[model samples]
Target: MQGGAQLPLPNPDSTPAVPVSGHSANGAAPGPVVQAKESLLAAAAKARKEKPAETEAEKMLREEQEIMRNITSRKALKSVMENAQGISYTRNLKTGWKPPLKVRQLSEDQAQDLRDRFHIIVEGENLLPPILDFKDMKFPAPVLRQLASKNISRPTPIQMQGLPVILAGRDMIGVAFTGSGKTLVFALPLLMLSLQEEVRMPLEGGEGPVGMIVCPSRELARQTHEVIQGYITAMKEDGLPELRSLLVMGGIDMRTQTDALRRGVHVIVATPGRLKDLLHKKRMNLDVCKFLCLDEADRMVDMGFEEDIREVLSYFKAQRQTLMFSATMPMKIKAFAESALVDPVTVNVGRAGAANLDVIQEVEYVKQEAKLVYLLECLQKTAPPVLVFAEKTADVDDIHEYLLVKGVEAVAVHGGKDQEEREAAIDEFKAGKKDVLVATDVASKGLDFPDIQHVINYDMPDEIENYVHRIGRTGRCGKTGIATSFINKNQSESILLDLKHLLQEAKQRIPPVLTVLEDPLEELRELEKASGTRGCTYCGGLGHRIGDCPKLRSQNREQQRNTKDYFGSGGFGGET
Candidate 1:
């Protein structure tokens, strides 16, 4: 274009290039496939120079368009490259290789030994499949290549057991720690199945996705979507049919997602509310979705997504596989699984409601008013990349601002903030642009941030499970970390016994006060044992009942005496 800012030429290496394995007999380069590369580049440059952004929204929209354009161009280039003579489709598939089913059936003693070693318990017909190594599984070469590239030689305890059950066409429940590779336990199997099904029965028009992953929060949904995208890219490069994945969640352009839906997606990683919105609006459908996964199922129930989940599930057709994964299995989660899953296999890798053993835990008995002071001191002494947690959104913001004013780079994520702000805060923290992240329990769940060295509970969470997840932010993926909590009598007294027990179980040092606080349950039992009726139901005081309670009887007698005195003394005020 004349007198326009010239767009930079696309780098041949910048395209998504896969390794070429085949060579021609003449030992020459593969024939060049023609594409409108120069014209597309010029058009993109012209579009950018033709109009200047007038507002923030406009600029954001333009940026999004540019990104989409770039992605489309790259995809086109990859297609052209794949069509070259030396690069053949289906070359990445390990032909005729399958995982051994003999290992699937283990003797009772062997299963027991395996359970003891990994703390894994399998329920329901001993259906849990054992993965001695990643290589033992029947995976596409691209999936294996991606794992090897990342140096993942063996499966985590959760992955080792969970994969087989799902692949066996059975519903499964996985209760593992926060960083136990739970996402892949389902994603890998689902993708492999989708590839097989797509080849066996090509998708009809707008048949929708064969795989669906629902996460509790937007951040977690986005993260899971990214991981799925990586696998999808690897699969595509390895000559599998193009299977598109979409992230349908709040805080992004819904129209873009709708457009993607119109085009058709093979997989969807979404949050409950947004997915419900799309489903209700008739913008998407899940009738053909064969695989369903609820990542962090316990967190979803805790966040009041049970109703939304049910509402979405009502839309799904029968004949689908289901998987539920959580860090802890509460009664609600168990009930949910019973309702959603059919004869599911339960895989528990570790003790439920326990913090990661790798974390160093400590307690600071500070009053609510003084927690800020102690937190400041702790921050001053601690290293960077710390995650501070608060019980309330307001407190998260306050702590975040206080740290900033004190000259520490910090960010905050909480329910009060919009999705964009929360995402931005998390991005900044993940990028190491911020040294500290002040957050509420919202960030404590399935969101994975790497190398977090410290987790400070500025305000100890109300629930014991929250406490476990909060501290888990630091000690992740088998890394050593520190977790310090600020506790007070008013807020933390009720959970003192359980907290102390958990810390002791993890072999962590407990504060003196925590050890001293009486257990409410034991105290109640003692009260019941001492007195048949511990307290008066009416008066709510110990050592009394409504009929014979001293306080109540005395009040009734005093009222009668007052009534008699009023009638006898008033006698019409001398001449009644």
Candidate 2:
């Protein structure tokens, strides 16, 4: 082509010319193109020959998996050998535990007399006598000192019987009224067991905790952990080998808990969900956990933790001394105890679902719209350091805000709040900085708030058991307190009837509204009295007999629906 000139077009039928292979028409070698292709091929070959280095996280995970595999293998081998020898893994584990000769030497007459005096009823074979005083427990000096420091001079009815039962290494089912010192019954024994285990064989990394306490709520778990820590601190001060503990619950960093586990712990106080999560992830094992206490067992079951509890129990390779303690024992808890505990002694300090005698329960009829205004009046009925319980979180928040706007120093907690917020509210209320606390049912069970002058139910709970627990916040540790519950037309008659019976049982004044509600089972109860029997052996609800128990029927329906769903979802290969 001529420079700056147009070239002539070629014919359509003419043959096309081709350039040489790997060379441009400009007569230059394609060195760069060739090098680029070679570079790509070399890189592909290198990639095929070598693998990328693992990240730090991957390396740590692999190491953990390897360790877990080794541990599992060793456990399997031990189990197989033990099975072959027909030896029971847990038969000899608790042999070292024995009641003191003084406790054992008590005659049956004296034991019966003590039980009668304390109003304690114990059922089980080979039962030990109840301890009349804290000194009768023969606890370690540090433990006794801790008790003394708390000014706990004597054991309550439940503690009187429960201490001996647990200290003797017997599985137990403890039923008592709320605020009956049920915690110490199991807590002290757990500490003693952990100390005993540590003294015999110090725990190494991934070896323990020797004891575990499963609480129904995060707040309860934290409280139990603090209690154990107090005793642990006392023991350490007295020159005992230091014992480590961990609080495992949701709403906190898992890494912190995992790190604590890596260091080893002698006692673990945990909630079911978090504990099950860690156990499933292999972050902790129950191989060395011989003592397992289910605090607020009924509450846990009510919260739908029965399956999680069972799964956690399955992780144990050997039998564990299982203890179930609650203020109320429904049929479900009884069934659970039968399946979980081995020859458990049933220690009943008072009838299940009974109100605390020390609490003066006051019921009132207030319009639903006016409850907020009346809440302030209720607060005026008592001094500061009062607890107000509402059934819903939204109501709790509303009350909290209302109280604050009205110049009342109030803090609120519920399941909906962040963990930090909940903890802060509880801490403030506990530290006596807050005058009042508004909360949901989450705070109803197993929370120990000392010196709580009053508990006002802004709204009545649906279940009678919850009412018992809510009012139980006050009147703790042999102190008299008051519970003011406002009931309106919106309240359920069933709960109202139950409340009426509970008030009459506690010998408290019943409001006109509650008094007007007729008890459906009054005739049945009279007949039962004539028959030398009573109402609801299953749920302890005086309003209904066993066959008519709402809780029992509800649970049965739930189970049946679950079964139908399971089968319908192809759980088994069969036609519907």
Candidate 3:
């Protein structure tokens, strides 16, 4: 109980013995334990006292750093996964297996004469002689039969040059009139590429699509898919390895497309949007994609698919042959081609953006209110299978309804319609079940309605390029067709002037209304002749000069505005 009383000895039978050293029963020194506890407490107190409150800037920095870390982790994981998948799919594929370069070498004078015969202008290094006949290209027997089946006894001007350029494993920028059989130029080469890969080692699950065709619209994509499928079927029937082609586009169930990819597609005809989506989701890849065709590439860029196209290109695991085909070769396309293609052959069937000479472009001035009424009159000029293009969706619907009310067999397609409805309308029109296919510019680019007797622009498009494409729907595959445009005061004078020049260039009759308009491009044309240049080379717009290019100016203004906004919003840590 007291210090002195504790000195009494305990009973030896029941008491525990005390240690002689200054240590606890657990054998740890008590001084160090206490000192360590005190030190930790002191450090905690010191930290609390010395630490400053986090400022907003510091907090934001911390959050940004954390976000960056997470992003980096995800990217690393994706890179690893993509690498593994790439290796797996390309494992059995033979590397550097190029198709035999079966080009017909010709003298410069002979080549020039051949090009002149078809109105073709081929520009590139080591250019191959244009194939005068389909048989000269050494296409597979099946491909030739398919061509024959399609009634294509000879190569179109574009096919004449483009086929040789592409089949020689050369990247090409094919600029031709809209109906110049541009599809075959890329489609046939794509088949050869796919067959080469498939026969060597057939595609398995999670593997190919050795070739891809990117279209701006689902309709174009489906049409291209059908074209490829036809060739595939012909080849298969000829005892060649089966080549599977898949149509990848929006408005269809993604699962179906994914399943097809899983089943190993040898060729994919896809719209930019859906293809990018699938690539982003990792449901498909470009690991084995050796051939890339951008059909209606300018239209895709106009539809704001430039970023998507670039993003899709970033997904390619290997260097692939790229092909860009468009009716119009604006400066934008030229710039894009410069960056995307490797020493690409520029095969121009005619002057870029020229209206097909095969088309009879008849521009008639009509009052805006009278356009609908005049549409019927225009339709009477041609038989069934006419394409009526309007700029606005509402206008397309109105035209479709009016035609139907007038007992005209019409089907309408626009962005407003569901995918199924659009497909159905297009199919109906193509099948000749409908006399008129009323549509927006969606049907203008890269749609081959071979039998379209006429194309009537219910409303003139603002851009002459659209006019070219709309009129090009007819007069396809070497057939003469008529195009009647109802222009009114609502149409811009710039476009009217362009139309006048276009008609004059084609040697078509220009209306008095367009003739009355001042020729602003006349002086420009004279200057271009002096300098070996033509109207607004940037946009291929005949109405304006490069300095006055509306599109280029608009793009510049947008870029400046975006930069200003970015700085104004404290993008670089400036005060708002």
State every prediction's TM-score relative to the real structure: 0.72, 0.80, 0.80
Better of 2 and 3 by lDDT: 2
lDDT of 3 by residue, 1-576 (tens): 766566667777874545555687787865322321347889999999999988553453355435334423422111243445653221122233232344444577888898898889887787778777877777889988888888999988898888877877887898998888899899988888888888788899999879899998888898988998899999999999999999998888999989988989889999888888999999998888888899888788767777787778778877678898899987556665655566668999888999898888888878988888888888889778888888899988888888889999999999899999998888888887888889998888888898888888888887788889889998888899999888888877777877888888899998899888887555445446755556666567676555555666666556555554345556653443
Off by over 4 Å in 2: 1-95, 530-533, 546-548, 552-576
The residue-by-residue lDDT of candidate 1 on 417-456, one tens digit each, is 9988988999998999989999888888887776888889
TM-score of 1: 0.72
lDDT of each: 0.73, 0.81, 0.79
Any residue pairs clashing in model 3, and if so which? Answer: none
Clashes of 2: 0
The lDDT, on a scale of 0 to 1, for candidate 2 is 0.81
Q: How many residue pairs clash in each candidate?
A: 0, 0, 0
| Candidate 3 error regions (>4 Å) | 1-105, 553-576
Among all candidates shown, the one with the greatest lDDT:
2
Scored against the true structure, residue 89 in model 3 reaches a CA lDDT of 28
For model 3 the TM-score comes to 0.80
